[model samples]
Target: MCKQSGTPLQDDLFLEETPTSSVTEKVAKPGPAVELKGSVFTLPVLRLKRSDLGAIEEALSERISQSKKFFENAPVVLDLEHLETPAEVLDFAALCSLLRTLQLVPVGVRQGSAEQQLAAVEAGLAVLRGGSVQETVAAESKDKKTGEVVKQVVVPSKALVIDQPVRSGQQIYAQGGDLIVLAPVNAGAEVIADGNIHIYAPLRGRALAGVLGDASARIIVQSMEAELVSIAGHYQIFEERLPDELFGKSAQVYLQEMALTLVPLR
Candidate 1:
């Protein structure tokens, strides 16, 4: 009743298929983990000539008037490089006063002679080129050493402070220790800290913490809802819209388990 199909060959000639798991195992594996890095903020330098104090003030005032929105709370570095004249001719205090009027904080002086450096130091402003001074001091100490005794020189860490509110378009930076802000940071403002950023008032602007690659650094703000928050180069932008509940609230931002988290401050 059944049409005889072709004679069935009994000898086996079939080859088994290779397992897919073996192919997957032969593929390259992932490389080592990567460490995230942070960013640092440097103030803009404003240079002036030795005999151009009046012009310096005028130019600075004009700049402030034109970009007042931009330099509201920005810190500035006064470059006295062109002011190579005698220290007696320079009115450091008056210059500082002028800067204060423009809402620019002059933290340090750069490119000055030894006498200028001395005056700056006496005026409570840190000397920018203190590295050479420190190195020379260290070398002298080594030369004075006679026996196997080595002098241990410890340079105490200095703290920088900002006692004013940070407005929009302004920026504040701390080089070493913690950065303490006693005022509110408005939108568009930027605050950077090498160690930690502690904002005593509301912070609606950008705040960067753990600058200089400090993963352990943290940002503490009285009020959150920041335009942008960054830590160790990782950043988050609230462009579309910030949560309504987060507005006008105290919060803390930090890196936890390689992720950025914003938590309400208790």
Candidate 2:
């Protein structure tokens, strides 16, 4: 009962043919273009010597309060090498949870026993090996009853040498090792190391040494025109123009009494 709706057919002379190639070109698909790559990076490690959680939480809270800027949301590698026994069972889930409550993210665990490794894996933590920082413990006894204290000496890794200039927008980090740059570091570049940093040529960018609380770390430069320089967490920014004596001069920067000190390189 409904009336039919339709367009009138056009005359053969009035009809125009359209090219199919143009339509195909518009709808054509491109080939797959995804690739995988690998790179190296640096991360700080937190060594654990005991399994007690309450004491650890209290101590960690105090430490975090002291250095809020560095501890907040920090990624850490958990080292279990300093424990009295490798076979000692630990509550990996509880440990990770406590760390997270303190804003410490645990990415991996190192130097643990087979069972401990499995527990960490079950807690969604990776097992790490042969990294720049390893087997280094700087933690106190977490056992409330035993009240035992342990100390560990960290042996720094070999120096990382760079023979070419570091261009702008480039970042170089020498984890647990000294960084030696034989060429200049251009502006907008960054050089960081956990031990020490040495530049044989002009340094116009930023240089940070002792990134992991190594107050003994130092920075030596042949021609120091750096925009910023830091030793451990102590830093000094050159807001105004650098002094003639300090700029383009051989200098050595170090930490003294928790302050940054710059002196002539002798």
**TM-score per model over all chains:** 0.42, 0.55
Candidate 2 residue-wise lDDT, 1-266, digit = tens: 95434443553233344446654345668876986786554456676777789988988898778657657898988888877666897898999899998999999998888888888999999998755333345655445677666554566799999999999989999987899999999988989998899999999998988876678889999999997898865677665667887889999999989889999876
- Distance (Å) between predicted and true CA of 164, model 1? 1.1
Task: List the global CA lDDT of all models.
Answer: 0.70, 0.82
Q: What is the Cα-based lDDT of residue 60 in candidate 2?
A: 85
RMSD of 1: 24.9
Taking every candidate in turn, the Cα RMSD to the unseen true structure, in Å, is: 24.9, 11.9
lDDT of 1 by residue, 151-197 (tens): 66544246567888888878888766678888888888898876678
The global Cα lDDT (0 to 1) of model 2 is 0.82
Kindly give the stretch of ten consecutive residues in candidate 1 with the minimal lDDT sum. Answer: 131-140
